[model samples]
Target: MTANRELDDILRRAADGGRISPEEALLLYTDAPFHALGEAADTVRRRRYPDNIVTYIIDRNINYTNVCVTACKFCAFFRAPKHEEGWSHPTEEILRRCGEAVDLGATQVMLQGGHHPDYGVEYYETLFSAVKAAYPDLVIHSIGPSEVLHMSKVSGVSIEESIRRIKAAGLDSIAGAGAEMLPERPRTAIAPLKESGARWLEVMEIAHNLGVESTATMMMGTGETNAERIEHITMIRDVQDRTGGFRSFIPWTYQPENNHLKGRTQATNLEYLRFVAVARLFFDNVAHLQSSWLTTGKDVGQLSLHMGVDDLGSIMLEENVISSAGARHRSKLTELVSMIRGADRTPAQRDTLYRHLKVHWTPADDPTDERVVSHFSSIALPGGGAGGRTALSVIDAQ
Candidate 1:
């Protein structure tokens, strides 16, 4: 009875927008009823966006180079910088992708890559400049704190200076890549060569203070403890309290296939839903919480809508990183809107900042543009990229 009352108290506190400590969050995650978690989280989501409209983005993840110096064991997409198969796409080639994205009604382009031994700040500055010059309208929401740290080291410049230069050269915002698990022990176990969780937040703080906002992400199921999971979000919430620059919080499970950390530890669907619910309760200050349909299937993604996720990630035109590891979920613009609709929420297309571009209140209102698709594996990455389709080639029959 005492334990049940504890769960009841936590749910009540969470539903009322009260802050749950790491211990309480862990408790709720481990014991609270699933639907209760969902109900409380849904209450929070509705409070955040009373319009009852769910949002999604039209974008493509462009992996500029798969050649990496930081060979994190959990990654399957990165090739050693000297590997024969490694390559880097030319500026013109990347520009062609941006052109395709713009034509397909994509407003954002996610530019992410591994830590190339020689590519420094100038490498990114040039790429950003070229992409922006070609498609000034597309938001270059690219890179992350990890890239910034690596480039700063390669260029022998300050992190602040690197961020300023890149933003000056068309880098609009940072994506929360390389932030696998921000806690120390698990992060070290998974990615020894990557920046520390503190350092990652430090770099993000610099970007935020510099006016370059970004989205925060978590890569779960990396053998981290439930307490550690709460620790991760606790860290993010602390940083957000100071910076207020993270536009959204996105959580996705790790794909442990071809990577070194092979399928040993993966979070279950119940675990994911519990985490999502707790996140909405804990991250009251963060404006948006997005679900990863790319990592979790469309069903789980839709189910997440009732569990506090206000946004479905994107109709990714291209995604090479997770595909190399085994994330095969895929959906087109229409299909994603339909999925959201089936969940009993209206669908809307949003940009990087969570501003709605188009809203579909009725089934007939969904956009009919065939080219607006989750075209992850349609085209082979002729330049330096990963093999296998990014949007799960397994379901390519679509």
Candidate 2:
């Protein structure tokens, strides 16, 4: 068969819910026509979410500490063990952030941070439990397999035990941090000290079995090959086939700024959208795919809704990691609702588990919480501090 025919066949097969191999995925990524590829992926999305409703979460990424031992080359967020700038939030400060998130209509709080050597599983347990005790309703979707692995090594405990302790301490779910690119070459080149890609998956699998579900993420750009990109998702697909645990797959571009790996490479808009289409068509088992507007910008994020993106990840009340790496896009709750509505899909506020909390069926009924803004300069300061503004004061300013 000719190349066009083969591409059409693969697209048709995938759109119809048939699983595509990594090789086939690479072909679609590199050779398939963009519009056709997107349509096929859209077909798959419709199959999964027939209601044509797009979902978003209102959450805050509370970076607990900047003192990291595993200094990733692509990271502009972490500080060395005792860097003068390094800081870890006190439990009261963390609780304050959580309170801010709740007041802004956020349903979840992602406790993102670096691997501080001093922090063992006990640290997370204490923090998570404290947050839960303060706000029992806020979903504590924090950390990932990489952090879990690091904690296990630090605390001299098994991986399973670490996850169990955190879960018992009220870690609702794991966010997909530390999954830069889940292949040997890129993973090692970017984050050499972090756990292996396989080990990352293993930790996630253990979390799934332990009844603590999580999400899968991929950091694009960072000088990875096209084949390696496909390999990354394929690895996640293989694991998803086994455990059926990953709640979503969020692939975002690498923001290179103020970091050691600055401008070495970055995924373009076309590359990001094509990969989103390809990932949706490829992962038959994963239930949701998120568009990372934090790194990719809002226009592409809006475009992704039709390209098999079911979730426009959080109208993040605060995000520091990507913002620290030069991601400048900021969004508001009403603006996000308008974007989803403009895309011809009903916008719904969802919880961590993808359950719809509220649906905006008409423009007049859309939410109007001005305080639910993305990383404002005054808010997402360095070192996970909530800057000098009190949450309510910020709200009053709005």
Candidate 3:
């Protein structure tokens, strides 16, 4: 049979509740027509989430340190230990950001940064504890596998102990940030200094066993083959089958600017949509599939909603890493809701843990007329101004 026929057969079988073999999944990823794949995946999404609405979260990404020991090739955000601009935010700085996030109506704070050498489990314990003490209601959804391994090595503590200490301090959920590429060969090629692919999953498994749930992410278009992509999802699906601890699966394109991999480009919209559809079809054990608006533009993000993505990731109050890598698309609560409604889906505001906080069926008739402001960094705000800078910067400059 032709590749298209085979993919159709496999998708039909999957829709009928039968499992598709990995070989068939490879064909679906490579040969299936875009609309066909999206339609089939949309069937699955509708069956799972009968409501015709997409969701997003109000959150902020607070990078604790730009000083990283593992200089991943695809990362434009990390700086070496002795780099002139390399810096680590003190606990006070982090808390201040958390305060800003809360004030901006952010429900979740994603604390991510490079793996610093001197900072270990104790650093996280102190930081998380302080954040929780200040903002008890904010969800401390932070960290990734790379940091987990580094913490274990630096502190001479076991992975379980590291997770336990962080959880005790205030980490409610873990963000699967360091999972750029999960296949051993491709992962090593892209981020050799980081933990091995297997080790990344191993730490996540340990965290899951210890009652910490995390979202799984895959950074595609990093020179990995279609087979490698399947392998990445298969690995996460297998782990989810065992632990059932992954709350969602998020796959985004690799940004290729200001990094070692500067010559490369991100995956095309078609390729990204195919991956999102395949993720929905293959990972039955994973509940949510999130579309990356930060990496992909709003149009692609809306297309993803039809291709089986239930979540639109986040309205990140402040996201520096991807911005540093040259991702320029920005969204606010008003714009995000309009995009979801334009796609014939309801727009619901969700907390970090996928709990629906507010659902909007109609677009915001009048946009918020609050005074536009700029942060010290070049963050593309909803109203076309920078945001998140300290008042001191403005005063000192004057």
Candidate number achieving the greatest TM-score relative to the actual structure: 2
Residue 140, candidate 2: alpha-carbon lDDT: 94
lDDT of each: 0.86, 0.87, 0.81
TM-score, cand. 2: 0.95
* Prediction 1 global C-alpha lDDT: 0.86
List, residue by residue over 1-398, the lDDT tens digit for candidate 2: 23599898999999999988899999999999889989999999999999999999998888878778898999888889767778777888789878877888889999988888888999999999999999999999999888898889999999989999999999999988888899999999988998899989999999999998899999999999999999999999999998999999999999888899987888899999999999999999999999988888889999999899999988877777887888878888888988899899999999999999998888887998676677642234443333344432121100
Clash count, candidate 1: 1
Ranking by TM-score: 2, 1, 3
Q: Each model's TM-score? A: 0.94, 0.95, 0.92
Model 3, residue 245: displacement in angstroms? 0.8
Q: Point out where model 1 deviates above 4 Å.
A: 1-3, 376-398
For candidate 1, give the lDDT of residue 306: 94
Residue-by-residue lDDT tens digits, candidate 3, 1-398: 23566677888876555667777788888988777887878888888888876888877787777888888898888878877777777777778777876777788988988888788999899999999999999998999988988988999998999999999999999998898889899999998888888888998999999999999999998798889999998888889889998999999888777888884656888899999998898887888999998888889998899898999877776777877777877766667777788888988878877777887756653235232211223322233234444322111100
In candidate 1, what are the lDDT values of residues 32-75, reduced to their tens digit? 88888889889998887899999999898887787888899989
Clashing pairs in 3: 53-346, 374-386, 375-386, 375-387, 375-389
